[model samples]
Target: MYSPLVQPAVSGASSGSRESTRDNVLNSVLTHGPVSAATIGDQLQLTAAAVRRHLDSLEKDGLVEVKSVAGSRGAGRPSRRYVVTQQGQSHLGDDYLDLASEAVRLLQEISGDEAIRSLARKHFASLEQRFSELVPEDADLTDRIRALTRTLDEAGFAASTRRAGRGGKVTTLRAAQICQGHCPIQEMAGEFPEFCEEETELFARLLEVDVRRLSTLPTGGHVCTTHVPLGRRAHASLMAHTAQRAEK
Candidate 1:
């Protein structure tokens, strides 16, 4: 039963299987993050101990992070939700960003800044079409913003929405901000700037309300932040949106 070659082969296979399971755990965290460990275990059909083991490895490696929230069962213990860190996203990998940035730079040199602006505009127009279709025509600003956030998440932007406020509490101001933890084209956008401008403009056009970029990932902010006014001039914005659609 103890053949040298066969024993090493079995050991290697076991190690490979463990690595595969770890990758699955990491992906589950990314897709359903700010999610609890139990939930991930259930989704992956892994035991609690197994999931925790993988998560501990990921956390130790700086690929996963945890947030403690008040547990519903009682206040004595808090539930931990896991989300991938920026480094974790890098682990997921974005190949050729450097090459893409060089391509955009070349385009700018050949065609000028307006050409880059036009390219950016055209680029986001498709995303606008895809994201807008996910929201209802009469949805309120909260629902609308959340829909956009959902779309962004599905697009791998790692986006989340939060009510914009000063201090730690929700602001009285009627505005919310969309925070994207990861941007696929961050490297390229940093050089051109047109991509960010066009994306902000796209949000305004889709929401039919003026929006602002408070900060951006390329600008050295932790996340890309966009300020969206909530429930202001809804009717006017709707009318403007309708008019724009008609003209197009």
Candidate 2:
């Protein structure tokens, strides 16, 4: 007899703990899939059985689906893989997705693309203003970048910053890269790339420096990357200050 896997709800078990585990499993699939239950278990340090139980729940909830991969040799059974469904992807962020998309489409139909672009710019400007307040006027570029990354992460972008080049008397150019691991409005942004453009412009204004977007998630890049030049003049001035301090 085939029996469905039953997860017992323990009276002593904390709902918060169970919810956290479920979220971790979902996030693992969201970030690193189409993957196998075994892979998810290894990444998340959950037992294989536990991972499958969570996967089953996710599948039942319409958040994940199983895919079959061909066996290495023709004789064996195909391997089962798991991938997030469209509904699953949407569940990861932006609850008002349909409404937001519809609103953008209606705005475009009513007022044209420029109106949509204007709205995007205006929307992102609020983010800029909020982030600007968090970073002090005297904060250096790195401090500003860190502050912006923190804000993005809190807003569910999973953003991080990294420095690329050496900054010294010998090196005149340096750059910082901001990588957003996820975008809440990736689907909407695909249809309205103005969202991305407006975001890039907003970033430049907030940083008070020129920045270039290298890639975006909507266009199939793994992450959204922005390149920010620390400026040769700023580097030269810092080097000069260092030399003056050494002379003193």
- Best candidate, TM-score-wise? 1
Give every collision pair in model 2: none
Model 1, 69-164: lDDT tens digits are: 787677688889887776876777679988878888898899999788878877766677777788878887666677777777667776766665
The TM-score that candidate 1 achieves is 0.63
- Overall lDDT per candidate, in order of appearance: 0.71, 0.71
- Which residues of candidate 1, in runs, are more than 4 Å off? 1-56, 59-86, 166-172, 234-248
Q: Write model 2 residue lDDT over 1-248, tens digit each, in one string.
A: 10101211222124567677777777665554446888777666777888898889999999888888787586688898786676776777777877999999999999999888788876665566668778888988767787787777666775666666667655436788887656889899999998998788667666667678998878876567888878533345544543343232
As a TM-score, model 2 comes out at 0.61
User: Which ten-residue region of model 2 has the weakest summed lDDT?
Assistant: 1-10
**Model 1 collision count:** 0
Candidate 2 error regions (>4 Å):
1-19, 25-88, 165-173, 232-248
Candidate 1 deviation (Cα RMSD): 10.4
